[model samples]
Target chain A: MSEKLKRFASNNKQLLIMIGVIAVVFIILSLTVPSFATIRNLTNLLQMIAPIAVMACGATYVLVIGGMDISNPSVMAASAVFGVYCMTTLGVNLVLGTIIIILTGAFLGLINGFAIAKLKMVPMVVTLSMMTIGTGLATILSGTRGLPRLPDSFSEFFNKTAVIIILLAVMLIMDFILTRTKFGRKLYYIGNNARTTKVSGIDSESIIMLTYVISGVCAGIAGVINTASIGTARANMGPQSQILDIISAAVIGGVSTSGGSGRVRDAVLGAFLVCGLTNVMNLLNVSDYYTTLIKGGIIIGAMGIASFRQQQAAKKGV
Target chain B: MKRILAIVLALVMVFALVACGQQAAPAGGSNQSTSQQGSAGSPKQDIAEAAPAEKPAETELKHVKMGLAMQSLQAAAFHAWADYLAYRLDYEAEQRGYEVELVTLNADNDVTKQATDIRDLIAQGCEVIFCPCLDSQAILSSVKEVHDAGLIYVSYCREVSHDAQGDEVPDLTVNFASEEQAYAGMVDLFNIMKEDGVEPVKLIDCYGDKTDENAHNREHGLRRAMEEFGYADLPVVEVECGHWEPDVCGQNLAPVLAANPDANCMYSSSDFLNSGIQKAMEDAGMWHKHGEEGHVYFSASDMYPLGIQHLREGYMDTAVDQGCYNFAVHAAAGAFDLLEGKEVEPVQLVLGTQATYKDIEEILATIPLWGNDYADY
Candidate 1:
């Protein structure tokens, strides 16, 4: 048992250290902020983090496959709006509306995927431009208005518990694809070394684009849940700032932003850790500016820890 | 693996297409209570047209906590709302001899997050929730959700009210932050200009985001006043759109100042853009106190802390106080009334004060400015 524990610790040093840091933050917040540790606060915190975590789950694929997507914010809004617009204006039933929303995300993701994979555009620039375009498209679709008066959800995706369930499902499925599928292995290979992946006879481009489509599908699911829970579709949804939260969660949860290894579970943990701070600050009556500053500090601290661990490993010739 | 992926993709799209066909067929309906958007983003329906929503059936307060959710605290006025709401709730608790804790959250302009924030408030055991509805149409379902949960939901300045559609959703809305607030300021500022020997004021309408409803409302108010004051035919100078944030507002206004060197009487959408306006004015050697040479008459809406200071020190001409503090105070009182199961007005009105340097002190005497009252906070 000790030997197995030692081997796991040795292999996942960064994750172990991250868990420690997260635990410390949890303990400190629980000690200082009144009711921070209460079941109600934690449950509410779960509700708050669900959509963000789900978004992060999709983002894990992008990051693991050596990509970055800033466009998720606008993509989220545009897709959600189109879906709801179809439901309310186009007279699509709730099921069709929900599917349309996912398809919209998939379509946008396809554009992103095609650009980065086929045209070989820079991931950040392509996604950033896509973000602005998505925002504009959302405004146009909703006529720069909120799309509310939504019909009853066709799926079991509404309510607080349902949102959390959706998050869990997304996390498991994304994790399974990454850890247990031939598709995920190809993604890791492309992320680790494109040249090597090509030399190894892997159809990296197709896999890369497919991964983006999957990311889009995840985003669509998130949109459906948001529209259901929010009961309104606006051009500006939660993804505006949540994109950053998603990225931070991925990085903090030990998903390498520089490409290579990542886990959906780790991304979920990252979302919890990042969002928990906001929850704690609100409860304590602390300002959001402070929360932003602290989050930045934590990210930097996370990077510093990763760098330090690498240095220690190199010194020991591990 | 590719075959599996292809099959899954094919099946999903096929299902979506079939679902599209299913929309026309009468489907199994669930008894839903949530609402949707009315206009673009702002509530387009007239307040008078909105029939009072029937209160959520048999809903009862579960907890003793009160909540105030703001659209965003990036604007100073919302911060004031949070502070004043807390203070007002505390004051109410003292008067009522029962403590009701406060839970405040900011959606940061994200409507979906606002939903989650409302849910959190519900989970935090808040009995009543107050918000300056970010999207009037977007918040209808949330209003229903709150009422269904046996809690009270109160909103201010709704543009897309479900009540107008005759929904059974009984969400009380406060009538604050309206065009009337801006029109009142324009009228008052002109009178002040007459009294201070700055009469015959030629107005330069400094625009905000052209797409924003607030900008249009304030500009319309200014235009209405200009027409009333006999300056309706002024050629509209197009200013750079700032999107209502300080950094962007200031950056955009710089070029406008450079172009109109002798432009006088700059009226903006909101004094929340005062920082940007002040920065540009000071840079162009145009910023001066009242009676100072190169002093451009500055009138705007939502007299935030800086706007109040600008008015107090005679740097600004007029500030259309949107009654943020007043609205919050009333909302807090309304929440208390709802908590005690007392009958309350569905549409409560809190008239805003059009404060100028001359009348600000007098107005301050009667009205509580949250910025001034909770400045230390």
Candidate 2:
């Protein structure tokens, strides 16, 4: 039993650490804050983390390819605005509005991937430019105007608890695709060594481009959820700061910055971890400054631990 | 990587510690603007305008479509303004004997998007456009385009310049002098402190987005008030919190808190800033403790849901509630006038500029803590 435990500990070190930290945080906060342990609060916490969690899922794909996708918030803002515009002004129904918006995000992400993979632009520069371009297009398409009042039926559909359930279902589907599909295999291979994968006859450009397209679709999904959650598609509803939060969740969940390693399961766990932390902070009335300080520390500490473990594993010839 | 992280953490900690040691004073010139101009101008009679049913003689009803380009509606207070204006216009358009179509454009805080939204609105057959701009130049370019198209374009709440033809071609009407709102906020804060009999009080004056003309005007108003209130001798340092972001406020004010143990009062340009200040103080446990009767005071303009609740709960002392409902009503009125070809001048509708204190119990009693409870998208 002891040998089995040791094996588990070494192999699942990052997961163990995340669970331990979360458990400790929960215990401390629950003891101190009356509202921390409530089911109602937990439910609300899940709702609040919904948008960021969805974005983090997409970001995990980008990071797996040894590239960063920091444009989700911009994509979300743009999607929400454009979605609402198509609904209200262009006289489209909600489903069509949603599809058009998602397609727009996919197209934007495809262009970004083409720039990065085909043109050999830095991922940072490419994604950053995409962020600006997407935001500009959203605002222009929205005509700087929000769908001030959504139809009552639309609002009702968005406000239902079923929305979150549906999103979780989407996450499950994404997880299956990442873990079980050929496309997923290609992603892992490319991230591990692009040159080797290319020599093996994998279309690296197509894989990279398709990943971005998927990232864009995920952002669109997040935007739709945001519209429902906030009950308005106000442009820039999720600002630049939200991007940092999404990245934090992805990293904290066990997605490596170096790429070729991570689990879709980790993204889910990371979302819970971040959402839980924010909930506890709110309950405890922690100042915004301290919250940010702690958040940054956690991200760095997680990366450090992961890197250190990797180094130790190499030294041990594991 | 660890060394880099450590250095960054240390720098942040140093900044935090240094901030706690400094004292905050009222912004420069807080007392000067209102005491000079507010007193200099004769008090306009508080006579109410004609009630909603009666149309003025020769009132023309032209079905006109108007557009307002917004930078973003993330700020709840501004969102309220947009929602209120749209709701009121829709509610009252029939009563005013006109068909009106109101369009709002969210620029997502992008300057280029703001310019493009303006052009799109113009293309949508909007005769006049009201803009709370993201970028002054971007909005101005749209103004030039709309003017060149011979559309009656005007900037409201935020000001924009006229073309070479001035107000002739575009037929623009600029309203809501932002400077007045700032002056009013500062004067109210000063009077609140005076009424509390708090003297020699140190304060942190938080301002927002210095690049924004409205925010700058608010800062200027507070500076004007300091000179008039004899609080000019107090030490005041300025920090700009970006467009009412709570996190930015916390970042800037955290340093200020570590430096100034004697900070009993804080003045913010926007209610959004007040919420941040409250969060900072609460975190530091400065709230409801210490400094001459043990209450840290805060005041700001544009009372939002949180701000209104804070004021009611004794966390905040005074503020200027930019009558959003009135803003909507007046915008409708202005739009009607423009449609009717009524000669409209440069008019600033300064609504709900009254200073509220705990003593004015009746007035406080009437102030709705939360209105329009249903979320307006």
Q: iRMS of each prediction in angstroms?
A: 19.0, 14.9
Q: Show model 1 residue runs off by greater than 4 Å.
A: A1-47, A89-93, A140-144, A154-157, A160-162, A280-290, A293-318, B1-63, B156-171, B175-177, B189-243, B246-267, B277-298, B308-316, B357-377
- The digit string of per-residue lDDT tens for model 1 on B95-165 reads 55556666567778777777767766766667888876666666766676677678888875433353334
Cα lDDT tens digits for candidate 2, B1-377: 53344334334433332232122111111211211111111111101122455763335754767677777777765565565555555444545666666656565564534554565565556776777665432244456567776676655556442222342233444445556666776677677667768764687878776445667677777777788887777787565575557778878888788788787777777776766777777777777622336686667777665666666666777777665545555665666667668876645454454445453345444443222221131
TM-score of chain A of each: 0.90, 0.89
Q: List, for all models, the DockQ compared with the true complex.
A: 0.16, 0.03
Question: Could you give the CAPRI-style class of model 2?
Answer: incorrect
lDDT of 2 by residue, A104-189 (tens): 77877888789888988898888888888776776566442234434546646754376578568767877787778998878888
Whole-structure CA lDDT of model 2: 0.63
Enumerate the chain B TM-scores of all models: 0.70, 0.74
